[model samples]
Target: MLSVMVVAATLFSVTTVMDSVETSIEKGTARLGADIMVVPAEAEAQAKTALLAGEPSTFYMDRSIEDKVRKVKGVKAVASQVFLKTAQYKCCSVGNMLLIGFDPKHDFTIMPWLSKELTRPLGTDEIIMGRGLTAYNVGSKIKFYGKYFEVVGMLEETGMKFIDNSVFMPYAAMKKLAEESKHKKGVKAANLPIDKISTVLVQVEPEISPQRVAIFIEHDIPGVKAIVSEQVISSVRKQLFVLLRSILSISIILWIMALLLIGVVFSMIVNERQREIGLLRAMGAKKSNIFRLIMTEASILSIMGGIVGIVLGGAFLYAFKGFIRSSLNIPYLWPSAAEYAVLVAGCLLLSFLTGAVAALWPAIRSMRMEPYEAIRRGE
Candidate 1:
């Protein structure tokens, strides 16, 4: 019973983490708010890496591509964004933050959500922060490239580290910063790369196929690669599935070993208690009562073992969540209280069933034993 509970708890924890991470990633991808992303052909891998790592990175292409993308057939809307990599210790309270520039007039990605949080459009010198940014809050001021900006709003958690850890500002503000940086002393102003954009976001018309639009953008646009949001997410899902399969395979093997060990242990226990069981039968206890007695003992042991296992497993998961996420390179969100309650109940129920099943044959054999013959054999 103890072995079974231990293996079951470990399996449960692994599956729960994997499921939570996969779900969070899917939800975060959906909230990205773009059907397709267009970036310089040389920057595709770096862009994906930045997205996954939630780190500041700079990659740029000609800003003119935005106009070409907007003119493409089936294009409903096109927004251009610039990525600025902040210095580790200069012009910012926090180090190595990613600064994103969005066009308020043309953006569909952040504006719709930003509108709900703020009553007015973002000012040129004001910024909205992602939830994962801990250093600044509403009304707090942050410096970027020697320029100061106030945090006007903060976005809700999106579970994607890239969006959650980034800071968003108006494109005009970023442009002004870039212009000022050229003359500013002691700053890496040359990194700004004026007249270039980091990426272009496209929203396809309702009747147009996103995949087709992505292909069109790739062919029509020079020096750029077009990525369909669904395809990118599907690729990520496939990678996660591979990890899940490996975990599941190991868990199955452990579970089978646990079950076999538990069965053997229970059989020995029943054999050792034969005299006591035979005595009970001789004293007017029915066969059903003997069976129930043995089953009840198994249930109690299973329940105790399960409780211990759950405590150990839950503690381990809670204590090492951050470490686990970093080590595994996966995003994870803890289950809500109600969801955890369900998981706990499931573990207990599975442990109980395993105990009952493993003890079934032994219990039946005990019940069918002749009292005198069993007592004699025991002596």
Candidate 2:
């Protein structure tokens, strides 16, 4: 029983970590797919490759493309965004950061899905800081590029590498910031057009295939590249699936070894108690009574091990949730009661099967013991 408990705890911990990692990757991929990404024709290769490699990259495209993309067949809506590369500040400043500009009312990805967590909605002079934006939150005013904006919302931790380190604000504010920076350095608008956008997100009509639509946009829209949800998430999904399969394989091997070891141990115990069994049989202790004793012992061991395993697993998850979330780069939520219950039941069932299998050899051997000879040998 003690051995079973130790093995069960180890197996459960391994499985729990495996599940958390896979689930985190899956959620991250889903969140990354909120919209189809559009990039500049010239930087298409760079942008796509960067995204696939899980690195950050930006491209330049005309803001006017928004109107054109919005009208494309199968395109439901379009929003433009620009990302500024990180820069070192003269003094202590927000670390490696990204400045994203979007139209709040029109940007479905940020305004609809993410802003609900805020006390107030996003606006032109308001910004929504990502999880990585430090020393800023709702009601805080931040200045960038000489343009000031109030932090009206804050994003919950979504384990994406880029989002955790970026800040999101309105396109108007970003443009204003650019103008201010240019004026400070005496640069002219003619040299730098504020109408440039780094990328765009297009929402596809429900009836249209995203892949087909992406192809159409790529062909029809010159100087632009289109990528739908599948293109971005497929690679991540494959990586996660591979990891999950490997972990499950390990768990199965551990479980089998545990069952076999348990069987061997119990077999030895039954052999040592042969004379006791023989005496009981001679005294008319029914075969069923002998069977019950073996079964009860197995059940006790299995149940105790299974329960301890589950509790330890839960504690591990609770203790290192933040670390896991950061490492995997996905939103975190406490395991729902339903999920936890399923884990407990599944573990219990596996344990019970282990106990039952381990008891089989002992059961058969004890049933065949010769009463007189077994007792005489013991004497």
Candidate 3:
């Protein structure tokens, strides 16, 4: 029973964490809102890292790339975005945040969701906050690049750190900040080139293949690499599958060892209690009674062990979740209360069944033993 409990608890906890991480990654990728992202060749790796880590990164290519990409075959539309890094200071209510600039006319990524929040297009000084921006509320002002902007809307939770912790504003507002910072001595914003952009988002025509378009852009464009969204997501999924397979392999080994241990323990108990069983049978107890007694003992032990295991497992998962996520470098979201409860119940039931099945052979042996033969053997 104890072995079963330990193995079951470990398997449940590990599976839950892995599943949560995978789900978060899938949802984050889906919400990226671009078919293909065209970034400077030198910045391709950094861009992927920033997207996965949910951190702010700045890398730029000439604005002329947008025009070139727009002219590519099978291109439906193209938009340019810029990344601006802010500093953490006393005057700033929100800590360091990534400021993203998008063109309202050509943007299809954030504008769809942004439009749902606001009745009008984003003004030059107006901005939208990500869900993770807890420092300020709607209608509050945020200071960035030595300027103040009004927060007109807030994005819903997407579980992706990049989107959740970011601030979105108009491309014109980003340009204005760049111009203003040129005269502000010692400001980091002045270092950013006004005519450069961080990324180019492409929307391929419905009948056109995004991968083909991405390939075309990569081959035709110089100093830029185009990435298809599905390819990136597939790579992430493959990595996750490798990790999950290792976990399952370990879990299966432990489970089998547990079953064998439980079976051996039950067999030993039955042998030591042979005299007691014989006496009960001599007093007219039926074979079914002997079987029931052994099975009942197994069930009780299993239930107790399962209860303890579930509590311990839940505690461990809750306590070390942050450490686990950081160590794995994966985002995690805890299941809701109801889902956790179901998981707990399922683990307990599994443990109980395992214990009962492991004891089945021993119970049957005890039930079939003759009273006189069992007593003689015990003596």
Candidate 4:
């Protein structure tokens, strides 16, 4: 039973975490609606951090890159965004939060879905906020770098921190805010350059491969890096799995030890039960019956232990979901119903097999014993 519990717990916990990470990546990239993200060569890490964790970041690239990328073969559209960070101010709802300024015309991704939340066209004084900024409502006002902007819309949750905690506005509004921020007393001036863009989201034609387009973009442009959206997700998944492998190794060792312990325990129990088995044998119980009884008992305990471990492991993950996301700085989403079912089935099966295998030798040995001699040995 203990052996089964350890195996079940390890499988459940690991599967839940991996599923959440995978779900988050799929949802995040889909909502982003871009095949490629182009940024300054040096800001690659910073861009990933902001995109994954919703951490406030400030980075810029030449605005002219937007035109350069549009000229790339198979490029369908290009939208530029400016990234900004705020200084600590009493009026700011969230300190040092990310603020994004995007071109409304060329944006095919984030704003289209978010626009549904707006009753009218977004005004220059209005902003769209990510769901993580829960303290504010649609009509609420937020001050950034001493410039106040009204929250006009709220984005649906994307699991990606960048989308959840960010604020979005038109490119013109950010420029206006930057202009006003220069005169604000005791505040860090917005480090936005009128001629600079932070990131360029690119959508390519259907016939072109995103990876191929990304390579071309990088080759045609210097001082910039074009990252494939899928590549970013895969890189993060690989890095995290490498770390998880060590934990999985520990779980594997525990499983082996549990199996050995269960075998030893059942062996002791079988030795002590020789007298009982011998009497049953003398009473005409078949060897098959004795073997079946032992296997059945082991199977019952294994199933029960597996269930308890799964429940406990799932509850632990649910209780600490936030802590896991924050500590890892990664997006997470719970497994779908179908996914949970498959995982549960797999864990239970493994547990059952482990217990049954451990008890096999003990049951076989019991069946081979002669009745009177077995009773004498038990004495």
lDDT of 1 by residue, 1-379 (tens): 6686686678668767766776667666666778888999998888777666675788999999999999888899998999987877575566688889989889777756552467688778899888778777788988877778998988766667778889999888888887887788876673677788999999999999999999889889888988787786678778877887787788778767766777788788878888887788789899999899989988888777778888888888888888977876644556667767877888788778777777888889889999987777777
Point out the worst 10-residue segment of candidate 2 by lDDT: 184-193
What overall lDDT, based on C-alpha atoms, would model 2 receive against the true structure? 0.67
RMSD of 1: 3.0
Model 3 per-residue lDDT tens digits across residues 1-379: 6776687778678767766666667666666677899999999888886676677889999999999999999889998999877766543445557889988888877756542467787787889887777876689998776678998988765656777779999989888977886676554453457688999989899998999999889888988989887777677668876987788788778878877787889899989888889999999999999999998888788777777777777788889977876766544556657767777777778777777887899999999999998888887
CA-only RMSD, every prediction:
3.0, 4.3, 3.7, 3.4
Q: Rate the local accuracy (lDDT) of all candidates.
A: 0.80, 0.67, 0.80, 0.84
Candidate that beats the other on TM-score, 1 or 4, i.e. the better one: 1
Instruction: Candidate 1: give the clashing pairs.
Output: none
| Tens-digit lDDT string for candidate 2 (341-378) | 66667777777778877887787777777788768766
**TM-score for all predictions?**
0.86, 0.78, 0.81, 0.83
- Give me the candidate number with maximum TM-score: 1
In model 3, the Cα lDDT at residue 81 comes to 92
List runs of model 4 lying over 4 Å from the truth.
Answer: 112-120, 137-140, 145-153, 179-191, 278-288, 311-323, 333-345, 367-379
- 334, model 2: CA deviation in Å? 7.4
List the lowest-lDDT window of 10 residues for candidate 4: 112-121
Model 2: what TM-score? 0.78
* Top-down TM-score ranking: 1, 4, 3, 2
